[model samples]
Target: GNRAEQKEDLRQLVGLTAGSDDKALLADITLRRASMYLATADYEQAVKQAQQATALVATHDNKTLEARAYRIWGRAQWQQGRANAAKPLLQRALRLATAAKDVLEQAQNYYDLGQIAFLNNQFSEAQQLLHQAIDLFKVEDDKRNMIRCLDNLGSIAILSESNFEAALTYFQDSFRMCQSIHWPYGETYVLYHLGNCYFEIGDFAQSQETLGKTLTLTRLLGDRAAEANALDTLGLAYQFDGQLEQARAKFEEALAIHDSLNDRRGKAYVQTHLGILLSNLEEIEQAGIYLYDALSARSDSGAKETTIDTEAALAWLDMARGDSDFAQERAQEIAAWLQENGTAGVELPFQVFWQCYTVLKLTGAAEEAQSLLQLAYTQLMARTQKIQDEDLRAHYLESVVYHRQIIEAFEATTR
Candidate 1:
């Protein structure tokens, strides 16, 4: 509801009831209003209402309601990407809920904490916490919360573990449950994750198909953030499918939305992707511009993975422009960083390694080229096996074949 409608309703409720005497009821209503504000993405109003609720409930010795208020406040912070700030509030909620023996609130706190852990890239901790929430939700017969848990678990599987098959199974189960419950919103989330899993597994066709549904549903729901994310993933699907023009259009559209929203992280991510796509298309000058811009954005955002990815693209662009010495130096720096920081099982690092192989091969650094080619070939082969679709598998295998051809050519020339 709008603020005016909510205020009018609250006024009527207070007038009809005994006003200050109904402290518990007022606190409950305030918490509900806070949740409504949170749902509308009004974090400031949500936090304000939740604080009011907390004050009201504190006077009445209502620990459960106070815990609920804290949870709402923490959730608002989490939605604003302040995971660190949200954690202590959620933990306090959990502590209070545990003291009150409020099983459902405890479960909710666990789920929120799991989300924080996932955002922090602590996948094992997230999995453990989510499993706890799922178990508690199942015990309480909370089907909706269980579905959310399953969806998040699927995300952890994909983003953390890189287990696309397992992630797909989780998403499929969650999707079926959402359908059974007639929850279109839940279904949309499940489909979005399914699309991402398909993309990760190299099934671009299915990825595009699923993301198309997600985009349609997000549009229907009028969720700009969801729409932007769907478009971003759809762009990746198109890019992987070799549809460069379609990919560029999708990326541009997503970028425009992110820009309008002032979502710096989203803009940085999309910019990195666009830089990579332009590099692959051999638009060297434009690619260099985008790559450098993306690098700056990622660095500002402290997005380490994306920063490395943009740097890799820029280095590759240097090589494409016949600056082999500069490219080699950049590639060596990136290789050292990857070794020290680890790749986090992401495909970008492997793509960087492939570029490194190309640079070394062309620069007549046979020993370095052979070593990097072997590493890239192994990683590519492993990734190819994850693509269950035969055509997609073959498409992905072409990279491995190219790597082999380069290696063979090198051996022949050297011999």
Candidate 2:
């Protein structure tokens, strides 16, 4: 369905219904119009249209219509970043829908509430709400929303805790459902997430294959944003697997696409990746160019990773430039910050410690270096203990370059 075409059609119908004697029908159409407006991100118009629907149903005995109106208004408010204003309206709508026995409306309300909780970082509450919504969606046979719920649940499993196994289950469920519906767009979206997860879980072969499929689908669908994402993530898969040239090519492709789309943030992200990759290749000048550009872009955009990643890359650049003392200082600061505050569900601290360990060992600090490496390895071991899946645990140990490197480093010292 072409959303723009549908919106135009609905607009025409709403025009025809203006001043009609049938108030309930008009209210229904208006509420629907409000939803179309919301879909197009016209929050002001969506709220206005919803208000009209509410006014029409004020003297009418139509709880369902009132619920619909309130839901639209609440969603509009939420989209406008007015969560406080949205919550009460959504609750009121849910109560009305429940009283009217509107199962679908109730599920919609639950889904919205779940989204709110997710955005608030209340993952536990979000999971419970999404589960309740999924139950109702199942009853209604709403497979589209069901897929959406599963994806959100998978994200919660990952973001709240590094429950990669559980996240994989949820995403696989979504992929299957999307396949059943023959929805290529949904399948493409799912594949991107699956690829990232596979990379995180250290299944590089699977990650590359999944991302290859994602690239093919995104090309077929002409989804440039998705295409750029696939390239960037696939580049990371190659980068982590020690294929530096392949990684650089993919990063360059992704950067070009981002430039074409004028996606400043995406450009910054890929530039930073390219900088780090170049640093690993010992191309100090090229790495510096990309790193400083990324630093500026991220700073201007207020991207939080401005300090963490770009600074880390710059430290690597310093190491590649043979400035061991400067590299050690910067690496220590970055590693300390990561150790104290942690990163967003990544083992970044380990990578920092691993890099700095070499500098320490070379600078007559072998004992300290070994101790630092052991501490990082201990942390990695603790995380692996939490993963119940045997195959995933094995993959993390064997396929993850960082994990494998640290283990080898620790063993060599003992030998």
Candidate 3:
């Protein structure tokens, strides 16, 4: 039985010989190191390890090892917020797994690919991939993976505009599955997401209750990453409810954790959230500082490598300062990139568009704001697939709802 220390040493030894002649051994070692780095939120390092593993597969003609490498590499790339990069890698992994007659590997590939597509706003593609993975998991009698796919599918439905009731159904189904399996991780994760959905549909009480449950579970599990996420969402819930002080406390606590972990992505999230919170409180100076930090990070890291939240935060701050010239410039840049990446209807990034609309409304650019807001509505309304997980669907809904409200307010201001 290998203890933690032994595991650590074994991992380091594998890393040292990862470039050696033993292709199979190198692939396994590289994957292991990638996992270790991912667990610690060292996304770049994980990508490096995954790439090394990928290289070994081609060099040695190790098809089996190559499949695993592609899968791990895709996951690592996704963690770096590069869903576009991850998509094709996951596709290749799926292809390799199918060719090798590895059902489990195929299921994992579909599951990951589905998630990447969902994040990139390709709901139709996400649903298809998730369904395939779900079917495979069912045949393998792997309830865990089935529940995961259900959760993801449910989220996609909630984010998409069409068929809210259907999306809710999926969320319920996913929640029930997690409950039946006694999967604490899924239970908490789902609840956190569900809370967001409830928030989106104006079900503040339910959102608060579910989000609270998620926070409790994540704390019990000692999962700092999930805890931070729960806190951020919970804070947003409180903010929506006019509990500004409580929201601030939650955001601050989340920020502390992200900083301590040195998670750049998490830090970027916290900074963006903090900027938004301060802006809402009318603390213009402090908000400017936080927003600048977020934008600086986003610009330095590359847009694809940073969360949309950071870009949105900076854009909002720019608007708040009446820097319409710069804000519009950024919006144009984002809109072009989103279109180039095949995101339609809402060609502007959701959060950033709302910010841009807000500025336009405030500046009495009613016609322009209305045009953009209509696009958002049209994009959101065209989504019709049902997501089959309660918690995750809820989170997706919540995000949509929050942005929706921003658009609504923009429209109202014009009247």
Q: What do the candidate models score in CA lDDT, each in turn?
A: 0.77, 0.81, 0.71
Candidate 2 is scored at a TM of 0.71
- Per-residue CA lDDT of model 3 for 1-415, tens digit only, reads 1125545696679668855877778778878777666644566777788888888677676666788888887887776557778878988988888888889889999999888877666789889989999889988999878888877776776565445565566777878988898877778777877887676555667788998999888876656677887888777778767788988998889888877666555666667777987887778789888777766665554546254556656667777677877766665555445435524323224655666566656666667767666665555444412434565355444545445575466457568
Taking the tens digit of each residue's C-alpha lDDT, what string does model 1 give over 19-136?
4667898888888778766764566788899999888888677789989999999998876667788999999999999999999999999999999888777889999999999989
> Per-candidate TM vs. native?
0.81, 0.71, 0.73
Candidate 1 at residue 401, lDDT? 35
Predicted candidate 3, C-alpha RMSD: 6.0
Off by over 4 Å in 3: 1-62, 260-269, 296-358, 366-415
lDDT of 2 by residue, 285-331 (tens): 98899889877876663424344677767877887788878877776
Q: Mark the 10 consecutive residues where model 2 has the least summed lDDT.
A: 341-350
Pitting candidate 1 against candidate 3, the one with the higher TM-score is 1
Q: Pick the candidate with the highest lDDT.
A: 2
Say which candidate scores most in TM-score. 1
Error (Å) of candidate 2 at residue 171 is: 1.7
Clashing pairs in 1: none
